[model samples]
Target: MTLFRQIYSLLFGLFLVVVMSLAYVQFTETQSFLSKQMESDLNNTSNSLGIMLVPDLEAGDIVGAETLINVIFEGGYYQQVKLTWLVDGKQQVWENDLKIDGVPQWFIDLGFFKTIKRESTITSGWIQLANLEITAHPGFGYHELWRSLTNAIIMISILFLIAIMLARFGLTWILKPLHDIAEHATDIAHRKFGPDMALPKTSELKSVVSAFNSMSHQLKQIFSSLDEEVSELRKKNLVDQVSALPNRQYMMGRLNSWLGEPNNGSLMMAKFDWLEDVHGKYGYQVRDETIRLLSEKMKEQLDEIAPSVIARIAAYEFAFLITSGEQEVCSKYLHTLIRTVNQEISKAGCKPNEQFYIGIAQRTDDMNVSQILAQTDNALQKAIADDKVFHWFESNEKQLYTREQWREHLSSAIKNKNFQFKWQPVYLTERDEIIQRELYCKLEIAGKEIHAGQFMPYVELLSLGSLLDRCLIETIADSGLLDRNHEPVAINLTFHSLSDKKFHEWLNHFLRNHRWAKRIVFDIPEAGVYSDPESCEALCHIIRDNGAHFGIDHFGRQFGSMAYLQTLRPSYVKLDQSFAFYDESEHSSELCRALVNVARGLDIQIIVTGIQEQPQLARFEPLKTNAYMGFIYPPEPVE
Candidate 1:
């Protein structure tokens, strides 16, 4: 039982014992007094009646004696009254008998009072005429005793109930401060800090409340300081101080994460071959202004593309990662980007054609980091040699599907349920084991497997993300992968599906029916959460309410506040792939440590991706992150 119940029960028991004891004491005392009073009354009546009867006897009026006895019996105070004459072999007798009334048989049967008789001698001078006898009935005594006992009990019982109610309210009021303290601790455990509690009048409780408030304040300060330090370190290492774009180290780390994904992006490098000549002629100020102007102009032109990055790889060279995989969109972006670069250079009083050239490289599954850079450099040579603003590398690759063909391919895939599952396992650093497996789904068209990024752009363009998500869900549900014996899998939910109420309804019903659904963890990208945090948070609650789990994928990828973790506390958060680009550098270590501290404070597991080297594990293990996923255990077909 709880403390409240235990204390209440004890109080109730004490009240009962006191009320019962009071009633018993009152009843017994009243019974004793009635017994003594009856005896006294009997003695007094005998003395008085004997004197009156003596006169009648002496005067030879036996009839008067009989009349007196009859009168006494009719009064009903006595159950039996007797009269006798002490003459020579003659006697006058009077007798009466009556039953008790107005009392229960059980009360009378307790035999608390018995019959009491008194006899007195009557004579003219000193002789006794006869014995005047009087007996008292217990009926009236029982009735009086019963009435008084029950009345006392009734009054006491009412008092007892009222006392109990008062006691309960008082106890609850006294313990309320403790309840507040408990709730405060629970909130802190969940990373929720509430305002300080009111100081209780009770000294013991006041001390406890004060301690909790102190701890909460100190924790907040500690976390704030750590966050600021990490933020500063990131700015120093990842940010280019000149143009304020990402530096080469930051881009390399970012590329590591981007390449780990199954999708490809267009990597464009902007260079100012005339920078050295201009710097020597116009001095350092003009050169710095030119670099700064280039970045500002690029941001204005590429404002439409999101989830992308711009980085300065060298003093005069900058790189852009265009996330679009569509050939037409990539070409359009490249053309607009070249125009912006030429405009910025011309505005800085430098001719664009004098020494400015751009190199474009498209990522492929067959290419690695070194090959991409080599190909981009070759493309830059071609641009300068041909006197062009930019040159895109030729790969002699053919498009798999046209715009109209994509619709048919996707419809057929959804209808046929041709989605295949692959599991990419993440390493749990603490346990030195694989605890989380991310499910990567791909569509199969004519025996060719296609990655998500290759098709998701089209999926969003066609507005069929919801349909595809539903189809993929059903396929996974029917697959044997949900068996209790298998490890739990994490599946990503599309932004469209999260926003769609119909999909939410279907998911609710599906989870209700499928018991094994608890083994699945729903995932949403950080960008999706940024788009609509409230809706995404509600969806997460839905998933968790149904016994399944949810997490944020690509966490810390955006430059938004991390405070949303308090409201949308997920089972886990996979750090953006870029953070995994650990190079044993001080800034890298600071970033990892800061993220881990924040995640641990919230009690949320943090996973880092894109660890490519065995030595990288050594660099990150000391930070004590929950898990890591990278090229070491890339996604593979689920058998």
Candidate 2:
């Protein structure tokens, strides 16, 4: 039992004992007092009779005494008093024997009797007198004793009832605070922090109440501190510096979790070109800002289609893990996403025009998350080699196009530097100077200028985007064209490139040794930068250490994505062209104006591309666009 119950029971037991003891004491005392009173009355009555009888015997009136005795005996008043006198020196006894004739000897012996003896001196003789013994009838004294006992019993019963009622009332009042404490304790056990302290004014409960309040306050403080730390960590972690998106670690964790599901899905990786040159000219702040903008745009664009997980998986690349059974749905969504991201990139107003190449691979239950990521990586290389904006993982059989066949072809290409590079100039419309150039690569096939869309899918299927990137880097450095003083070249990197420790390490080494490496600008796509912002930030540090600048290509494309821009702090934003070139709609122009104003407030430059006319240029000028390109600046051909 609880403490309250035990106390109540103990108190009740003491009350019962007290009530019963009082009853016993009162009853026993009354009985003894009445018995003594009866004995005293009996002694006094016998003595008074002896005095009256002695005078009559001394007067020697034997006849008179005998007559008196007869009279008293006949009146029944002397039933217990017998008179006897000496007559003629002989003993004579006078007695009334009324019941002797009718009463049985046994009854006479058993019935109540009172006996008394008296002696008197007469002239010439000593006489002895005896009084009859009589039993007192069970009448007045019996009634008095019974009445006293009955009254004592009644009083005791009343006392017992009163005592019980009082005990119950008192216990209830005393235990009220205990009940409250119990309720509060139960609530606390269930994880409810309610009713911190509302103890009664009783002195006994005050200390417990104070202790409870102190403990609760401490618990609340601890939890609050923990929550703050967790929030800070979440914001700080899982971000890339260049793209200002979730880093590779966070992305991989997310991908692994997504693939754990039974449902099959697809991943689309976007790799962009000329990000480094843009970063080198514009700076890291502008590049990261452009990436942040692009991420937001992509998220907005793809909001209606499917739930997507977009993250910066590498320096110049991003990966989208899209949930869909059909590859076409993923493909269509991927295209829309790539298109929107590229469009946003052109509007952000970077110094160098930013471009992207995307690779998509669908997920299967049979494939682990690592395997699927590998496929996206492979696809990214193919997209870069083919010089296409995007490519899908699905491939069809040609002459010798099995899975193994493509892998072999990719192995050979990587070993032989089979990929070729091209440059697209982005002109500064106001200055008429070539401020940035976008790099491209093509595969040689019988002297044909084969587009990236044709055979890039196979390269991606072979998981060689990093190898191709490595080969392209070595080839560009070997070409001797990087020594130009005023012209900085931007080349694309893939998510695979960032993951490839050898590739980044090699680039770092190359930048440290090469005399003209500072002119080489590495531009990462918006998706890549945002997917793993931390990695990009790390990459930025690496490049900065080597005297090369980091730039983000596709400017805007992600969901509610201010998270990246605030952290990475890139050099310039390359405005996505879709918003800039959206037929000059009022909402689109307003958005452009707002973005330019925001970028200007941050002291970052904004570059808009795809400008075909004076009106477009005029529309953008008010928005403080730093530069422009399009049909007005013809694409420079390679010699």
Candidate 3:
């Protein structure tokens, strides 16, 4: 049980015990007090009556004695009042036959009074009068007692309820501070080692916070010192101890960051393949001198583009991040720079023909620095593969044209609210009818619709893919289609959106309040799943946890990484159009069979793409594919 519940239970238990004890004491006190009062009244009444009857007993007037008893019984003040007379020293009892105090026999059987019978000698002329037997009926007294007890009980019950409520309120108030301290501690526990620590107000909590702060601060200092030591180690490992530029350890970061960004600039990468060759042919001193000379010549040549940053990313590799006005301008500058370096090396009288491979990718904001650099590296690999001196920067025109301008356009499109959802029908093959419709983002700019491929990169760059996904979720819920009993809708998400833990958390909460619990399907890409395998698997887990299904689009296109498919285990894999083309070749058939077997092992349903003929359907059906798209559904044209 929770602490709050435990506290409430303890408090309530104590309250119950106190209430029961008080109730029992009140009941006993009322019964005892009423019994005593009834007994005292009965003794006084009987004694007084015995004295009055004495005179009548001595006169031996039976009528007088009877009259006296009748008068007293008619008064009805005493409970069961009776009188007795004595004649010739022999006792005779006289009482009215009429019932005096009317008390029910059943009520009397309630055992209200245990009366003491007492007698006194009544003397008139030295004669003993009759003895009087008086019994007390506590019925009336008990009735009044029960009524007062009932009132007390009601009052006590009200007070008990009030006390319980007050106890709950007070306990809650007292524990509030403790709860705050616990929550603060939990949040701090989740923080990374170097996070800021703040003290709480409670004494014990403040002490704990202080200790955490001290530990965190000490850890930060230790890590800072350790980082400096590693930096020095990196220098020793990757760079010549004398040159302060960069060690080989810095190369990967440099290469990856460069590859991530795309812009309108040129990259010149030089590989020193001939250095070792020359060093092997010559003495150590001669080779060292040659290396120094070459470094100096390259530095001088780079000084022309001094506005750019030049760093030796590795032992044998140098990179320049130079800005040129345009593609042609950068291309000309690169050619000139290479020519100048060659000329300078020849004049120095060193080895005249040293080979180097260089490649460039024209900078575009469509990609990150790392992706751009990878493109340049890819070009260099192609140059080396073909044994060319250098390959010039080139743009993938068709792909770049769609992505480049649209990223900027999307920024404006978001601000102006130009993005909208377009629904496309999904068919259930067995029913031969529309099972549901999928929502696709359509971005409009000046009367043109830009597809997700065109604008999605910008969504990623701005970290708004989840925001866009949330907007789509809200739109679909508000659309009223989910109110239908069997309606389902598929929503596409980016890798960023799926991988974001915060976004997925919010999405889960949103789905709970939504009525479309069983009908929502999420569509993601196969390439994205392979990009970060662990996060992809976690994303799939969370989606399934929320009781929704997932589908893989563009599957089998980026062919080599099927490990994620088995690990993430998506509900269905939609084969890419490129893989579905008609081919009678063994290679194509082998690829198809391999995909089927792999998916079947994982129990993942498969969907074929671009099925334009009965022959295509025949091949997929034999493999037991669950669905097919393309002309079978007739791929829709972009609007």
Top model number, TM-score: 1
Off by over 4 Å in 2: 36-195, 223-245, 272-283, 293-308, 323-343, 350-354, 386-389, 395-639
Error of 1 at 525 (Å): 2.3
51-135, model 1: which lDDT tens digit per residue? Answer: 7677788877877877876776677677666666777535554445445666677777778897788877677776767766678
lDDT of each: 0.78, 0.61, 0.61
Give candidate 3 regions above 4 Å deviation.
Answer: 1-30, 56-77, 84-133, 147-311, 315-359, 363-391, 394-512, 515-639
| Cα lDDT tens digits for candidate 2, 1-639 | 987778878877887788678767765676566555545554554555455556666666567656655554454323344343444444444444434433445544543333323333323234454332322222333345456656777887787688678877887787777776777666554334554777678897888877777776665454444434433443455456555566665566556445532244588887755565458778888777777787777777775676677778777677777743346557668768867765655565432224567777766434666688788878888888887777777644223345575577567877987776667776664687877776777666556554444445455445576787778778877877675435777776766665566777878888899887777777665767766766777776677788776566546433234335434545567665444434454544554565555455445556775566777678877676776655565545444
TM, every model = 0.84, 0.44, 0.44
lDDT of 2 at 216: 65
Order the candidates by lDDT, highest first — what do you get? 1, 2, 3
Q: At residue 286, give the lDDT of candidate 3.
A: 61
Candidate 2, residue 217: the lDDT equals: 66
Error of 3 at 554 (Å): 21
Q: Which is better, 1 or 3, measured by TM-score?
A: 1
